[model samples]
Target: MADKDPASVQTDESTGQPEKSAQELVLVSEVLPDRIPVMPVYPRPVFPHFMLPLTFSGEKFLEIIREAIEKHNGLLGLVMISELNEQNYLASGLHTVGTVARIYRCSQVSEESVQIVVQGLQRFERVRVAVREEPVQLWEVRYHYDDRAVSVEELKPHILAIMASVKELLSVNPLLQEQLKALLQQVSYERPHMLVDLVSSVLTAEPAKLQDLLETFDMRKRCEKLLLLLKQEIEVFQMQDKIHKQIGEKVGRQQKEYFLREQLKAIKKELGLEKDDKTQEIEKFEERLKNLDVPRDVLDVIREEIDKLKMIDTHSPEYHVSRNYLNELTLLPWGVYSKDNININRARKILNSDHYGLDDVKERILEFISTIIKKGSVSGSIICLQGPAGRGQNLGRPLNCQCPRT
Candidate 1:
């Protein structure tokens, strides 16, 4: 396809803008050359119908830009560097297919660095290196065009689907609206290839995938690939939204619980009931441990349990279990003692009053009472009684009554 005449008043093919004269077009390309200076960009590939701002510091790149602007009608091949090689100026480092761009504006930032804005014109295939030298390198290239054109009726379904996906994307992501609004306004269903390029430039896909889109000249295939990319983008955004909402809801629930708990505390304080049950229980444990003449280790264990009970939440199951354990510990007769004033006559009278038969058992009990009277303490002695159920096995209760302070 031939380049459009710059002098004619027509819609700008790249931007779809209204009538503009040759002077406004900036670079008036009367005749395009096969061999033009090639500049390599990194990471991102520039697509046609888009403006790319580039910065150059090295004298080599600056020389290339000056030559392209001065002699080649501001036309140059903008190719993407496949990998960030130290020798990026070499032709081998750049992709074979590149965009033919015109220098829209150029300005010098510093003595060493220069900035240039370039608008992509069309796609081109680099045939071979026409010149490779110290200051500048030029490549012979063949221009490519959009192949297999399809009418609006043929692509109506895909166009509508693409529009729906784009609207969905805008609804989910507000940041993209301002950037894509003007570009979408330029989109036309008749120009399917241009629409494909416009959408491809904004996709959050890998550089290789986008570069493939740049290389694809088939109109229908490019649109299909774009549709797939849009669907994948939508799924990614939807999942992100779901995860964000879930996190927000969880945080909101926790905040509500905290607020309610604070309100309850304030209410209890106003009613003079703010001592809290857990605090009162802990204080009681401390008081019991202080009064009882417990052993050193027993006191230490009880104090440790009190500290643990203070740290635990009052409403948890573990808290109740720990409180019950402390209660049992404090209830034990730690230092309570009974006097050793055993009366033989009183014991014999109580045993006769309690049981009628078992004369041998009565004699054994009298002997044990005699032993305790001499020993002064019942240490190292245990009495064992065996009997069937409901057969007077509770004889020990009456025997215990004989002791005055046991």
Candidate 2:
């Protein structure tokens, strides 16, 4: 085709389908070649009529771009790279179908890399890759077009379906509205394939799906496929919007609880509490219990109740009940005590001043103290002062001259 005369271009003016310009016809001949340099990249396959820039920092890729532009008038094919490591992908991940992009502009970004704006001009299928020991390779490709055609009248239904789906998608996802509007302008009323490329350019699916769209040659089927994809996107966007709204509603309902919790936490923190009042209270209890002279069995009971207090929410009604239990526990004489030594003579004088009768009781109390002094260790015993209320009832006051108990 390169040696032959340019193919005659034809179109109808009424449908606004202009004939291919002489410049475009010449570009077409370049793609018919049996061998072309293929740029294997990780980007989504570029559809025809869409333009994007490629940045190449590697000297090899930059040289390839320069050779394609300077030596062959920017004739190159871009295949999608499917592997994570671009080194291996350059050799094995090359997809057979790719776009022929023309580098219309190139800029020297730095000594290491260059940036080039390449517009996808056509879709081509790789017939074979020219295997060589060199890092970069060329491909023998043929220009392929889906010859299966559908009339404009037949494509109207699918196009309308796509329009409705886009509108629905925009309702839930208005962020892309302006971009969609700009892309929609690319839709050609006469050519369904133009609409396919225009819509598919902005609609993001996986790179594989977009690649599938670019490789498709059946113009009408492409539009149908896009419509289905757009509808699926709409459903997904709607569901996401619904879940977001539901979560918002849940947060709204819990606003009071959240506010209360934060306020409580802030107040407790100001008072040197780390979590909540109950938690701080429990921590204080634990710290005190450590230095406290509590019996082992009683300490275990106190710790178990403290754990229960921790499990109870600060907002619960039973929190006070547990708090009351802790208060009762603190009421016990934790470390208080009395000395065993007592002055028998001072006790006899206090008995004479505080009491009138019960001379036998006074004599017996003196005798008991003398006995306790001689014994040196107290044996548990109950001492009762008899007679009237004022006689010797207060005599038990001095009995606590021993260890205090809860």
Q: Best candidate, lDDT-wise?
A: 1
| Cα-based lDDT at residue 228, candidate 1 | 86
lDDT of 1 at 208: 87
| Per-residue accuracy of model 1 over 1-406 as CA lDDT, tens digit each | 2445343446767889777754435443434678889988877788888876889997778889889989888998889988666764544478899998889899999997999898887788888988888567788988775553355688778887888888898888777787677788987887766777777778787888888888877667777888888888888888988999999999999999999998998899789888678878988887887777898898889888888998999889999999999998987767766444367787778778777888898888778878887887678876666666543434544445322111
lDDT (10s digit) by residue, model 2, range 318-394 = 98888778867865666767665467878887888887887987898888888888877668755664466543436
Give candidate 1 regions above 4 Å deviation.
1-31, 86-92, 275-406
Residue pairs with backbone atoms closer than 3 Å in model 2 (clashes): none
**Global lDDT of each model?**
0.78, 0.73
| Clash pairs detected, candidate 1 | 338-405
